[model samples]
Target: MAFHCYLWHGDTATAQGPKRDTLCGDLSMATPPVLTRDWLRKPQSMLRRKASTPEEAVNWLGEVFDQHAEKMTHSQVTGIRRQDRFGSALTDLQAGNDLSWGFPLVGSKYLALAVIVVR
Candidate 1:
């Protein structure tokens, strides 16, 4: 079973030494990070995420947002339905597997997101 997720660059040093064709000793596989209880609790700390792939991560988030985008707000009043600076990135779960929240761009204000999770 494949799932989608979002991916962001973690504070990792750039490639200095010869690139290791094998990320985790397996050139054909990528060592995905662990999705533990803490991950569900505090995602910021982990910084790193593990999904089927980078693209998958983005798609999942897009779908998540698309579902409840209408209930968010008509703030812009532009009628295009765009995301605002102040919103939930992944919050509003209330107490179930559902949630709604917002996130702010740190390094770059021109943040970009990917849509993952194949239909």
Candidate 2:
């Protein structure tokens, strides 16, 4: 199976497909012919954290949950479906604020993460 990423708004997924122009809608030559897992890596310093591997992602998610458990009420950590939105989700997850979960799909074929904005 190919990699898929998604952007979720809640129990209902806000976006169910890839966002890159090449992957969806009218294709463009500027879009790279090759996609790499590099999209899965969170920038090392941006959020004061990084996750180079699926394992690290899981650990980071747990840390965020633990640190914020006392303050969070209705919000809960959850899974994300793969589509084409890894970059955005990873950004939120790395920030460790409104983001909660960041991990790869069980089969290793896709990356997934969850975002929970408490507004």
Candidate 3:
């Protein structure tokens, strides 16, 4: 199964990279970080989602990751350390701070998300 990757910043989000088996490679080979860095450099490329509250924004991202993992991997992911990291980043975003979180999916493959407050 392929893992979908997304980058969410402010009120905009976009799917990153092509759909492929993302859980079988090293971090250096992962596409999420590269796509995220590119997006951060050129954020105007991102499309806006419908207006939503901060909590809803966070929940939407969490649900996307969780639901994808459950559906594709056939296992529920809960109480994982990565969830805590994502929660911390969400808190930082709510606090008006920029933050980034990296999650190891399987093997050396990783997923990275950042919440950057662009002036």
Candidate 4:
């Protein structure tokens, strides 16, 4: 089963509503990367933290990516796929170009997040 994933960016302060900028991953995946699934299986400590600033959010996301990258390095295909979906967004965030917010999927047994970037 394929699942649709997106990385959206926008400004929330406008009356026009959230302005979306697609940084990457406007595609469907048969399943999330193995490292991602494994990380999600761990305790939700990191996910529970609140990011009050864009810098903080970026830092948090960086850690998440770091974890994935460490394991992904063992598998070329998985690393490439994961990087394709999230690398640019992380790069942009690290460069101070945008802010990130992750919305957790409600009523789901597994941890699923929809990440939105605020420009």
lDDT of 4 by residue, 1-119 (tens): 11112232222221122321221121122222223323223333423344555445545555654543433325532535655545665565455443332322222212223233323
Worst window of 10 by summed lDDT in candidate 4: 23-32
| CA lDDT for candidate 1 | 0.31
Decide which is better by TM-score, 1 or 4: 4
Model 1: runs farther than 4 Å from truth? Answer: 1-37, 40-50, 76-119
Better of 1 and 3 by TM-score: 3
- Which stretch of 10 consecutive residues in model 1 shows the poorest summed lDDT? 9-18
- TM-score winner: 3
Counted clashes in each candidate structure: 16, 6, 0, 0
Which 10 residues in a row give candidate 2 its minimum summed lDDT? 6-15
Greater lDDT among 1 and 3 belongs to: 3
CA displacement after TM-score superposition, residue 85 of candidate 3 (Å): 5.0
Largest lDDT belongs to which candidate? 3
Which residue runs of candidate 3 sit more than 4 Å off their true CA positions?
A: 1-39, 42-52, 68-87
TM-score of every model versus the real structure: 0.28, 0.28, 0.44, 0.29
Flag regions of model 4 displaced more than 4 Å: 1-47, 73-119
For model 2, the superposed segments whose C-alpha errors exceed 4 Å read: 1-46, 74-119
